[model samples]
Target: MLIVTTLIACILAVLFIRLSFGVIRLRRQYRVGLGSGGVDDLERAIRAQANFAEYVPIALILMACLELNGAPLWLIAILGIAFVAGRLIHAKGINQPPPHFSNRVIGMKFTITTLIVLVVFNLAWLLLQLWK
Candidate 1:
């Protein structure tokens, strides 16, 4: 069972819904149907949602693979937690004004680090299986 991945995916799903609704709310407020309507907040909201959509699926896939391949439960939990926390921080940072760049940087660091680790771990596991 993909317990860790399931939990992480659920959390990500909720965050995604929140980000999506944020875009919708901004669109309604700005009266733009197709784009940000030249509104900065709306633009930020759109990008936040778009960025989340762009990064999450593959992360979840990698995480699920790790779990399915019998990676350590603790490692999976840590990675999942880091990814979720990173996404939350990034969403908050991206939605804020320009002064909060650190949040974005830190968040991306966590997210990217998690991805790299997942990739390495998955690759190592696959190689080990092949060698066996």
Candidate 2:
């Protein structure tokens, strides 16, 4: 069972829903049906949600694979927590006005780092299994 991945996915789903609502609220406020309607806040909100959508699926997949392959639960939990923290921080940073670079940078660093670690772990596991 992908317990860690499932929990992480649920948390991410809720965050995604929150981000979606943010976009919906912005759209309603700006009164635009399609696109951002030339509104900066709407554009940011849209991108924040879209960005989350873009990054999360693959992360979850890799995490699930790691868990299924018998990766340590503690490691899985750490990576999952880091990824979630990254997304939340990134969303918060992107949703803010000007000078939000630091949070965005730090968030991406965490996200990318987690991804790299997962990829390495998965590949290593695969290689180990193949050799065995």
**Clashes per model (N, Cα, C within 3 A):** 0, 0
Cα lDDT tens digits for candidate 2, 63-111: 9999999889999999999999999899999999873988888888989
User: Model 1, stretches more than 4 Å misplaced?
Assistant: none
Write down the lDDT that model 1 would get.
0.92
Q: Give lDDT per model, in order.
A: 0.92, 0.94
- Could you tell me how far off, in angstroms, the CA of residue 86 lies in candidate 1 after the best superposition? 0.9
Highest-scoring model, lDDT: 2
- Candidates in order, TM-scores: namely 0.95, 0.96
Among all windows of 10 consecutive residues in model 1, the one with the lowest summed lDDT is: 97-106
Q: Which is the leading candidate under TM-score?
A: 2
